[model samples]
Target: MSTPSADESVELEWDDIQSGALHERPSPYVGRYVLIRIDDREAGRELVRRLLPAIEAGHPTADPARDAWITVAFTYQGLRALGVPSDSLDSFAPEFRAGMAARAAELGDVGDSDPGNWEQPLGTPAVHIALAALSPDSVRLAKVMERAQQAYGQLPGVEVIWRQDCYQLETGRTSFGFRDGIGQPAVEGTGRNTNPHEAPIKAGEFLLGYPDETGALPPMPSPDVLGRNGTYLVFRKLHTRVAAYRQYLYDQASSRAEERLLAAKTVGRWPSGAPLSLSSDQDDPELGADPDRNNRFSYHDDLDGFKCPAGAHARRANPRGALDHENSVNVRLHRMIRRSTSYGPSLPEGVREDDGADRGIVFVCVGAHLKRQFEFVKTQWLNDGIFIGAPQEADPLVGRSDTPGVFTIPRRPVRRRLRNLPPFVVTRGGEYFFVPGLRALRWLSELDS
Candidate 1:
């Protein structure tokens, strides 16, 4: 096996992340979940052995100690084959929620459940677990994922094999409201990432050995390519600064909820897919529903930064045309199929202004390489302020500054443009993981046994 040199790797570049053939169409398979790192992987294995029967009986993982975060499971192929009923998804959702609520109670009070202020003038972006807390339970959770994958692999007739589905700490806005997963790359071969007809997975810098020449490879690669097609899962728990966000909006709002909503519109999308680019004053439900229309439009058409400001959360997360005309299409390929859910709760009504509460989203990204996809976006774009010296520093929505050089999202107001857009999110904890394929899972189970 030949390895590319450091310089060689750097030189390799894809026109867009999705510049090749797609292994599969982007589906709901990308469910977000959070794996609690337990103290011992063996201990977790032991618990899994005991819990298998119980989980089969429709109970949560029997391992009590391993339950720490509410995991979002993506796709049903594996579980369904294990005799898990296809119709049970909606029914099982509550069970999943119950499991999460129970786990949250064990961890700590994330926050209150008031969804009122979200519509108010200004509020700090709501805090929810974008990542899971560091604990011994994480080990157990990792083993659980391994076991689950292995168990599913044994079942019959699974078409598209999944290497791993991202687990995240359950987090999101109040009930009944949709949270849009924006900045998606079009199907690689489908013209979303690159020129139409190219495969989604490009080679160079995608996985370990594959170069960009081949284009988009299968999401779950053949075992021979990487020895184990287990892609890396980047786990990050981002704490949204709720109070600060609320204060900002409340301070700026005039009369109606629409004014406050407009502030949010500047960021694009109302937690839902509503496009502020087209409907800046109010969220257009119709536009939000259409993925073709919503994900396709950008602020580049109106360079004044009114439709979607350069600093807006959506625009910043995905600069699209702001970076360069074709840049959005190309870079969108790198976008991870996110399956994040909100965790924690809204701030209580009368907890005093200074009272501290913890809340955020458990952000998880499943990709071939943590460095190329997650780390590159985080360090170079999201966390790095003054990227290419264009706009402000760092993404105000979810960027964080930890110990200066390690990672810094410097808070700088938009110069000669919009005023006083503070940093609204912070990173509390994070880790990188390798989610293995089902075959790999069986291999690990054998090792564990």
Candidate 2:
């Protein structure tokens, strides 16, 4: 595909969209997430371009750039969808593949590498295909997804299923029972695609720009090197030790969940976006209404950790207090649009003692810089204990390690040696991928065709 032309004049505005502010707008109601799995890298990308027309055609608005938001999660398997089970899935694979191949032949490939008719990017690779994210406003987006199944439902070697999403956060980090999106930089825009405020808009600002106060960005392609609108996505299926976590909580206090849950509320955003801080003592329905009130609160309260906590997920994700003179830097540089969902099964009633129902979260992050936001949370706050003041290693909930997993609690010990601390979360699988803008998508499809 031809190199994408840069648009240097798209200025982004930084607006305060905390949980309280979001509630005034309207709950971001959404239904059925559509995912498509493809093989290998090249074929997966080609298929994505080929399917763009059909996918975009399904939307009510004809303009894909403004109306559609597409993010690709690259793992061992390029694209895979969860929670979309239709009976016609068996027949849709081959037809879609043929369409992708035909489109590639129509437009010659363009880039540093020469190409002709190429094999599907997968020889023995597995991938996931995520469609344009459908917000509450884009009601027709779901219908388009439904129609996609009609065209290729019976294709073999592909599985489509339905998923129950638990939470969605700013900076694109889902509620994984661990702190995410902490210390993320804010760009000047809306949705989960653009950068937050407090950061520069240089061509490589988010991607491969010069290193600032922090260490160098991860070894990934910068927007300058690749294109302005491209960003990387990381996906992982984390298994939360619900039973063990609960046991540790109960052992510590009379009502552990109730106490911690309240702390979450004070922060104005629940592990999910329920916003107990703004709504009722329980999960408030209206907190999702006003964005002004929902996301407007600081843990600096002396409320005995009732409204907020010393190390709650929301607090840990964005420790605004740590910034210049009371987290002024955090307010500017640590804002990210987190978009994540829960995976695995719900905890069964009365079935305590670690059943391993395989519950955790699907962590998906989008920002001008992937390493700055997602990677930072993973390596620093989540994995490194230094951010929390404790002399420990890794996040008690979702930190990474070479020796399986670990967890930590205030009082008492459950798994591991409570003293050395153990990981409360475990990682099953994860991979890094890129999400491209609509213009690039069209260019790719037309070029290879």
lDDT per residue as tens, model 1, 1-449: 12212222222212212111122212221232323222233433333343232121112222323342222222222222223233442332221212222322222212321122121111111111122222123465455455444533333332121112332223234221335455543222222342122124443223322433334433333334212333444444555666666665566566558445645544556645676667766777687767556665655675546555555556656665566654434554455544343445556532325346556655655655444466556655665546435433545555443222111122235423333555555544433443333333333333322
Score candidate 1 by TM-score against the native: 0.54
TM-score of each: 0.54, 0.56
Off by over 4 Å in 1: 1-178, 186-227, 257-262, 326-329, 347-357, 385-392, 401-423
lDDT of each: 0.39, 0.39
For candidate 2, write residues 1-449 as lDDT tens digits.
12223333433211211111111111242323345564333444455454554533121222322332323333223322221113222222221222222322121111211122122232113335544343344455455554555433655444443233333333233323323333233332223322222233232333322332344433333223233344454444455666766565445445856645533432335543554334435655355434334444444442223444334455556655443344324432333445555544556544447764656665555544544565555555655556555435444444443333333333223322233333455444443454544443444334321
TM-score of model 2 vs. true structure = 0.56
Separate clash counts for every candidate:
68, 94
